[model samples]
Target: MERDIIEELGSLALATRLKNLSERLAKDVSQIYKESELDFEPRWFTLVYALKEGEELAVTELSSMLKQTHPAINQVANVLVANKLVNERKDEADQRKRLLRLSTKGEKLVSHMSDLWGQIKKANDELLDESGGILLESLDKVEEALDNKSMYERIRSFQA
Candidate 1:
């Protein structure tokens, strides 16, 4: 009976439902990008969006905000600078420190993307009901539990 319950929890029906939802969300986001005519990948958008709200952030600060490494942030910043979407300037207080800010073009692109996201949110609202909120809350709990469980902790307290 226990084996059967476990199998039911991992059934193909549940897998298909999760895959379908992911595919739908991806399609919606892709459509929004196509409409904006913005050639940025998702990671680029994340950085650009962060800069849209402010001006001039140090590379290390940006990396911490994005939860990414310095090298990764630098690589993306270099591409943006080369494309003229962002500008890097030397800090006045510290000549050795470089600060990053979005250029005029980048600012416009981020504004357009924000509008597109609003539209996506409206569409999603139409598709989801009150049950959706409950499901999301449950999923959040599961994710939190998983995040708190380290591999070492799991091995030391193995029950299964």
Candidate 2:
């Protein structure tokens, strides 16, 4: 097997390692979406699912829900809009604000994919079990730690 420079870097390369893992999983998920004849990107899953319950929401709301930046939410929401899966409307009380709602197409897609979603969850659970079933819990702790004390803050404190 080839040597892994990122692995050799250990804790210093944690971000890269996680990113690589994410990309690999995304590739497989993207393939699944394609095979299903769905024109959705793996990245769009969260946003689409968020809108599946028939509530009008803003990009800001989606960002908060996904723990992502507003720009990221805007980018994904724009793609969903362009795909005709979501509709945008002026917020009734706030003229300058736009709210998003799932179109009939999006609702139908969500309904159609319900079974596939379950299978995907089962596959993901199996993958988690293969990895000892604690990765997600550990990730939650790491994210909480970061929220309480950011890496930059920790580095600065160490230098001080």
Candidate 3:
């Protein structure tokens, strides 16, 4: 059997390991969506779902809502616009601000995927539950601790 670098590094490689896990999971979900004949990417779901639930939202508002950087949201928005799944319009009250909303195509897709989305959510929840919810609880704790003092600052503090 080959040695696992991530397992060997343990807590010292927490960030790297978490990133690896996240990327793998995202790939799995993306494959499922592709296999289902859905023209969607897993990374786009967060913004898409937010737009589906809300009437419309400004770029900054979406950035805040999704807890993503403005540039990040804009990058996804660009792709969504190209795919004809979302539309960008100038906010009436603030011409400088642009609002985003799902296009008709987006609405139809969401409606079609509703059942699949439910199944995906349930499956994910079951997996977490099977882990006794420790994965989520521990992640929450880690996020809270990092929010108090960033990882960069913590590391620098330990340096000689």
Candidate 4:
């Protein structure tokens, strides 16, 4: 058996470990989506869901809503538009600002995935419960702490 460097490094490798775990989990769900012939990327789920709920949003608005970068959201939006999963239009009030809305295909895809999404949520809830339900609480606390003192600032201070 191989030694786990992340486990050995503990807090020193927290970010790397977290990223690895996130990727692993995402890949698992992506596999499921692919197996079901969803023709969607796992990364698109949040954006799709946001559009489904809000009906439409500008790229900047989506970036804020998803806590992601404008460029990142725009990139995904481009792909979504190309795939016909989303429609892009100039904002009526602001011609310079583009907005995104789900296409008919996107809606039908979402409707089809609703049941699978529920199952995924249930599995996540069960996993959290099995782990004493601290995962989400701990994540919330971490986010709050990070908001109070950003990781970038912390690293900069340490470097200085």
Root-mean-square deviation per candidate: 5.9, 1.3, 1.6, 1.5
TM-score of each model, in listed order: 0.60, 0.94, 0.91, 0.93
What is the C-alpha local distance difference test score of each model?
Answer: 0.77, 0.90, 0.90, 0.91
Q: Write the per-residue lDDT of candidate 4 for residues 1-160, one digit (tens) a residue.
A: 9998888999999899889988988999999998999898888988999998647789888898898999999999999999999999998889989899999999989999999999989988998899899999999999899989999999999999
Count clashes in each candidate, considering only residues at least 3 apart in sequence or on different chains. Answer: 0, 0, 0, 0
- How well is each residue in 72-134 modelled by candidate 3, as lDDT tens digits? 999999999999999999978889897899999999998988888898899889988997979
The 10 consecutive residues of candidate 3 with the worst lDDT sum are 50-59
Candidate with more favorable, higher lDDT: 2 or 4 = 4
lDDT for each residue of candidate 1 in 28-139, tens digit (9 for 90 to 100):
6776677778666655756887799866899988888886889999999999999898999988999988799999888877776787767767776766654465766676
lDDT of 2 at 152: 99
Q: Which is the leading candidate under TM-score?
A: 2
The prediction achieving the highest lDDT against the true structure is 4
| CA lDDT, candidate 2, residue 147 | 97
Q: For model 2, what is the alpha-carbon lDDT of residue 39?
A: 78
Cα deviation of 111, candidate 1, in Å: 2.9
Better candidate number, 3 or 4, judged by lDDT: 4
